[model samples]
Target chain A: MNSRKCLAFEIVANPAAVDALCARAETWLIEGGLGTESFPVAMLLRESLNNSMLHGSGGDPTAQIRCHLQRGRKWLKITVEDDGPGFDWATRLECRADIENCHGRGLEIYRLYADAVDFNRRGNRVSLRRRIAEVMTS
Target chain B: MTTVQVQKNDATVTLEGALTVALAQELRPQLQKAVAEGVSSVVFDLGRADVVDSSGIGLLIATHNSLKTKGGRLRVANASPEIMNLFKAMRLDRHFSVEGRQA
Candidate 1:
């Protein structure tokens, strides 16, 4: 029997709304037995959602951001899509170690936390897969 | 919610909630004020903070830069394990003191 769980939702491209979405998603993941995986999942959700809102939609309130989450026993997959002109994601994937800069660390966070990060050719969509530890059932 | 306490040349800022872009925008000015007031050291008490995003990381770095220009230092105390790992992954601990929450 397959016990995978999935969630799909959309939100307006607003920063505050993004925060609320992350919180809600975190709770959902925890309730679904993700345990420690919930934290990184929520963090990654925030990063990707913010990127979509700020860069993709240019903070346009009318733009809609779509998110999907799928959780299995050993992995969680997250996807975020924005309706905006995509950028050259290839140029921005390099993780920089510069601590003095206040920006450009979002991509690095994705790289460090997610086991696999993928972007569509348009760069308006990002999918992240993170490996999770098996939950021990008592 | 955020609170700032200053004593002598040091300041302690306790933050509760996710340290994302919105909170970063709200707290930036207050932190800059602390730095401008000649506080030589700033310690962020994030015991109540559950999560942090990239902008939150940017805020910390920016605050560190501001304090450094004035010969001050920045330290993060009581960060959750997940947050601590994020900071360490980004090598932020190399630039400032980052401590994990006590068990």
Candidate 2:
């Protein structure tokens, strides 16, 4: 467990910071022999982080977010925490097919792309996991 | 991050780049201007778009609904495999006119 490298960091709750986060995560994953997993991993990171920065913290630049990433031979784990009131993660996780609806699709994207999506009881924190081997095979 | 290049073939607008949250806000003005002139058909050329996140999807849907109110249609063309899969996975393909280049 300790043998595998883990990365943890924080970013201000600002959309502009997402690109750097994605770049850092993608580079880390690629360096870990998970380059093929970069797209989904990056996308997942962007989606969750976007939600955290925008919706969770209401785009408050002063608010900070905690991001943790851990990679193993077969799995990758991500958790994003924001300093804002949480939402009903259970209800919002459903995939809304209404293309006319302008919002509420972020969680659905998570469910579709990630192997599992979970949130803290407070809902301000989100956890995402992906099966690296499964993503590569698929 | 994303640029919505308007070819303006009367009403079509081509979009290229990574359509994520970082760019969605910047694109709204262009899209609004395009729709303002009562453009009947709006086409999003996503062939060069490497990524489309939920914000992108929302923008597309909003643009679709806006065009619909004017009796116009929105078409998404040349989406990458990843974007196409996103459309299908979210069942947005059924709602938007998504046509893969290979399809």
Interface RMSD per candidate: 0.8, 1.4
Per-residue lDDT of candidate 1, residues B1-103 (tens digit): 7788889889998988878888888888988987897888989999999888888889899999999998889999999988898898888999999999999
Error of 2 at A9 (Å): 1.8
TM-score of 1: 0.91
- Highest TM-score: which candidate? 1
TM-score of chain A, all candidates = 0.90, 0.88
Per-residue CA lDDT of candidate 1, range A1-138, in tens? 223378788999988788778877877777776767777788789899988888899768889999998877788899999988985789878757477999988888888889999999998999999998876543
Worst 10 residues of 1 chain B by lDDT: B17-26
User: Quick one: how many clashes does candidate 1 have?
Assistant: 0
What DockQ, between 0 and 1, does each candidate earn? 0.82, 0.69
Q: Against the true structure, what is model 1's DockQ?
A: 0.82
Give the clashing residue pairs of candidate 1, or none. Answer: none
Q: Which ten residues in a row have the lowest lDDT in candidate 2 chain B?
A: B1-10
Best by DockQ: 1
